[model samples]
Target: MLRFILNNDDIGTALPPGMLLLDFIRYHQHLPGTKIGCNEGDCGACTVLIGELQNWAMHYRSFTSCLTPLGNVRGKHVVTIEGINLPGSLTAVQYAMQECAATQCGFCTPGFVMSLTGFCLSHQAPTLTNAIAAIDGNICRCTGYKSIERAAARVAEILQPRNGTTPAQYAAGAQILPDYFVQIPARLRTLHSTLESADDVKAQPIGGGTDLYVQQHDALGKKALRFLYDQPALKGIRQEGNKCILGGATTVSDLLASPLLQAYFPYLNNYLKKVSSTQIRNMATIAGNFINASPIGDFSIFFLALDATLVLSDGRKERELPLRHLFKGYKQLNKSGDEYITRIWFNLPSQHTLFNFEKVSKRTHLDIASVNTAISITMQYDIINDIRISAGGVGPVPQLLKETARFMTGKLLTESLIREASFLLQTEVTPISDARGTEDYKRLLLAQLFKAHFITLFPQLETAILIR
Candidate 1:
């Protein structure tokens, strides 16, 4: 059975652990405000706000109901459109959308409103950029985005003077939300104490359920699954000495919000923008990305270049392996089924080290890459001291271009040396033709991306001469 606070009411159910939250809300509970579009979480029509206690503070984030399992929300508060609706008055976000004429056919209105409301509850700066980012996962098919943008801007204006107050306090004081929200943190604390964690020993471990629910929804619906999304042991980003450690179940959203990563990878946000939408990132775990073994996983390729290692555990025992070595073949891993990734750690790059990542995809965002590559190099006096190049969508698995990396070490920073290494890279990858692109196109694209790494890291290197 699962116990949670649904909207304002506490509920328990005897449904299967893998049952989707969308079905539970719309079918069993009979709440229709959360629509069902693109049941695969891409459409974001089923967007809902989930509030969970973290370090004694309540943090709220938007999630796609379709991909979220019922077990994942155990002991947390799941807020739907009905939870935020005022009987005789409009919420700040709702009023903004209505005043700006943001609703078109009204099918996707609730989702946008919920996403925006989640933004309101977030502790982020009430800036236009952050407001716009909150709704990146939502898509309005009627070309009504301009009006929605206006609504978002208006909402940001309303939150300008939030001061240092809590979201519940500020929102309630401003009449954006009801006064009941102010007491939810204490309520959640009591409710959380009574709930026990799902035993993962005898069940399949699923984090976020974003990918698994999409790929194996039918099978998962009937399987006994253990939810890892809220496991305290598998959530956080911390630094120790020269290494940075990230819990396996940490989401992309968590990584983006992490100050440690932001400090080291100043362009972390820009690099992640090339990944999927906010909704996907909010639920997709870094461990899931690596274990999925997709040749084109963005996080997998990114971490590979950093020489990251995975800490694997079976609840009782633990082991560590280099991330690149975990992938043995196409969709194959060098890990036992019982052993799961618990943590990932990588050495921090020095000040002299240069890092670059690039990807070309069908769409600029929310699409799989045709080719993705990353390189981290340290040079002294124009001579390469150390370097690592990693790429995906060009081999059976996410590959560390060993031959190419070895050739660049101790070599002077010259167009000729990198040009020669690019040729060697092509030989290292065994790309095959598929729907994404032809085999030859992938080969040429990877070569260009390699040169792109150099051009991006060393702007002084002429692009024309480097490619030649």
Candidate 2:
């Protein structure tokens, strides 16, 4: 039996496969604040706020209903726009949206409201940057983004401090699980063995359905979803030893709210803000971005530049390895079929380390990268001491520019040096043609982004690492 509190009500039961979230909420649960949109997961019309216990307490994030599966909701609590209404009147967020005239046609209103609710809780007030980052994934063909930003900020003024705080960290493996992904030719069993095979078949784990939902167009049917929806560790954002460990299910929105990340990786945050729109970031996980294995994953480039490591486990043996080593040539990971990534740890660099990120896309926001670059350089007495540079979207898997790193060793960054070094990169790397950019276009972008990073990292070493 899967025991969960739905909108302050309790339910414990079993369900079938391919049960879209929008339907489950409206039909089975009889809760209808969640609206159905383009069932294909593109339109953000079916968005809702989902809450689950992590570290023995509650944490909430917004997600799209069209792509979400009912089985994924086991043991979790869901709150739609309807539940968000206060006891006597409209919630402060709704009032703000009304005051700012944030809606048009009102079809996308529920999704927009839930998304803003999550955003306002995490960020006291929305800045232009925050506004852009939050709603970038949502579409309002009727009204532009300007009005939404105004509403979000207006809501912030009403509730400066969030009503509650998130609980302590919980590792995914150790948390209290209401159910596991047991293949159901048979139904759910006891409290502890929801995943036990009734037909003795193993389950396929699903996290942050952000990408899996997008895979509906594929010919092959999606594997039965084993919900990792409430895995505490997969939702965590905190420090562990010398590295900052982020869970695979941790949303990009949570990444921006992280004080640790903000203090240590300003450039990384800046680029992630531009990686996708506010709507997508609200649900997409850092690891999912890699799991999707898009050639141009924004976080992939940043992770490589940060010397990040991926931690993989399967309720048994656990292994940790550098992320760059995961690429098995193309669209493939070096997993033994059952092994899935549980968390990612980014090792912290020395305090004085200088790093910069540059993303080249056709548009400023909500677009895939043509060429995304991340550069990390540490200077010792004004000479290059250590360096790591990475490029994404150019190769089958995102990787560090080893040859480019080699060119910068022991050189002083200067205009002439940056220009020459960039040229060396141009000669060493080759990019394939794609819709975002052609082979020659990518080559030029790679060289120029390197130069831009060098210039951006100025004053620390005005000479520029690319020049060196």
Candidate 3:
């Protein structure tokens, strides 16, 4: 049985857990406000706010309904545009849209409203940048986005007086959302206490369902899947001694919010901004990215350069494997069918280490990468003491450029040395022609990205000299 609160209504249905929330909302519940656009997560036409009780307060995040499965919403509050409507007046978010004339054709309006409402109910500061970022996933084909930007600015101004109150309390008190939100925590506590646990060892393992729903949308509804997104054991980022540990189900948004990661990599937010949109990052999990095995997966290439390790479990036994060995071939993994990744850990970077990530894609944001690479190097007075380089979309699998790293180690940092190392990297992988780019283009792109790592890390090195 699937039980949850959907737009101020308690829902308990016998629908399959793998059934999509978009389908259930539009077809089953007869709510047409949440329009169906791109069935994939790319289009934000089906965006909704998912509120979960964390530490006795509701924390709401935007998620694309088309990519979200029914099982993922168990014991949580799911809010649609209808749920936030006032009796006879528009909420602050809706009024801002109307006042700014941000709607046209009215198809993508609900999604934009939901995303902006989510921003109002979030702890993020009420700034124009944050407001714009909140609606990055939504696309408007009619309005030139200047009006949407104006609306987002108005929403930020409306939220400027939030002070220090929790986002939910402030949103409710200010009429940005309904007053019923203030009562969700208590309702969720009762619901969670009575909920049954579904842990089937033989069932298919599903995390977040961000990618699986896209590839096997029709087949998943017929399969028995054990949802692992909310498992307590697989939902944290912690540090122990010299190693940083992360649960397999940790989402990219979790990393963005993590102070520990930010302290280690100050530019993490900038790098992640290029990874995907806010809605996709909020739902895409670390283990799911690794298991999806896309040749150009951003997280896969990022973690690969760190030489991360994974702990695999099969319910009865556990084992450890280096991430470098996890990829056997294109879309193939070096694990058993019953085995699932439980935890991922990597060594903490020291003061003497410099790390960088580079990617070339069709679009700067919210698009797949044509060539991506990351490098972690430990320097000993301008000489490379140790190094690890990983590249994607240049081979059959996400590759750890062992030969390139070996060639660079113990070498002095100079234009000629790096140039020689880049040449060696070209021979270490086999790239193929695809929609992203041609074979020669990827090779040239990888070489430039390889050079970019050094250029970014050592700006003192003349750019013209290296490129020439």
On lDDT, the candidate that comes out on top is 3
Candidate 1 backbone overlaps, count: 0
Tell me the deviation in Å of residue 461 in model 1.
Answer: 1.5
Candidate 1 lDDT by residue in tens digits, 1-468 = 679998888888999879999999999999999999998888889999999888889888999999999988898889999999776999999999999999999999999999999999999899989998999889897889999999999999999999899887898888687777778889888887888757868788888888888889889989988777778889999999999999999999999999999998998888998898888898999999999999999999999999999999977899999998999999999998978889999999999998988999988877889999999999898999999999999998999999998988998989988788988998899999999999999999999999888888888896664547
Which pairs of residues have clashing backbones in candidate 3? none
lDDT of each: 0.91, 0.68, 0.92
User: Candidate 2, residues 1-468: lDDT per residue as tens digits?
Assistant: 545445545566565544666776798877776777666555677777666544443456667777666666665566577655655656656776787888888888878887766655342343545544555557787865688888866654444332343211111111211112111101223322443322211576666666777676231123565666556667788897778988888878788878888888876567776766665676677877777777778888888888888988876888997888887777888776667788899877777588888997888876778899898888776678789998986777887888878888788766776677777777666689979889989988898788788678775545445345
TM-score of 1: 0.97
After superposing candidate 2 on the true structure, give the runs of residues whose Cα lies further than 4 Å from its correct spot.
27-33, 38-42, 54-57, 86-92, 120-123, 126-133, 160-201, 217-222, 233-241, 459-468
Give the poorly placed runs of model 1, Cα more than 4 Å off: 462-467
Alpha carbon deviation, residue 106, candidate 1 (Å): 1.4
lDDT score for residue 449 of model 3: 93
Q: What lDDT would candidate 3 get against the real structure?
A: 0.92
Candidate 3 residue 358 Cα shift, in angstroms, is 1.1
Clashes per model (N, Cα, C within 3 A): 0, 12, 0
The sequence of per-residue lDDT tens digits that candidate 3 reaches over residues 1-468 is 778999889899999988999999999988889989988898799999999988777889999999898989999999988899988989999998999999998999999999999999889999999999999899997955999999999999999998998898988888888888888899999988888887777899999888899899999988998889989899999999999999999999999999999999989988999888899999999999999999999999999989999999988999999999999999999999989999999999999998999988998888889999999999999999999999999998999999989988998988898888889988998999999999999999999899899889988876754757
